[model samples]
Target: MNTFFHIWKYPILLALLTMFGLLAALIGTGVWHVLSWITLTIPAIVCIRFGMFPKNK
Candidate 1:
């Protein structure tokens, strides 16, 4: 259980954030758009960071 959480925690969190961002963009009005952008940007930034500078192993 510990190992599972250790490996899956960030992925799960990012997935949830991405879902929220999508829903916010679809269903929300003013402030929600900004919120959606912020939430969505987090995962994109993570991906870009990893893609550009992956750990060498």
Candidate 2:
């Protein structure tokens, strides 16, 4: 994780996601639908992995 940020940084990823989302919204077609679906899943997976995990109690 550290190495990834060190090399590329978060803003790059954010920009890419934002661009894809904008493209998806403006052009709601076949390939764009698939691309946006795959792109949006990133946040869903992150939320499940980091927020919805079972914690030791």
Q: Pick the candidate with the highest lDDT.
A: 1
For candidate 1, write residues 1-57 as lDDT tens digits: 699998999999999999999999899789999999999999999999999999786
lDDT of each: 0.96, 0.74
* Candidate 2 local distance difference test against the native: 0.74
C-alpha lDDT (0 to 100) for residue 17 of candidate 1 = 99
Residue runs of model 1 more than 4 Å from their true location after superposition: none
Candidate 1's error at 29, in angstroms?
1.3
**Model 1 poorest ten-residue lDDT run:** 48-57
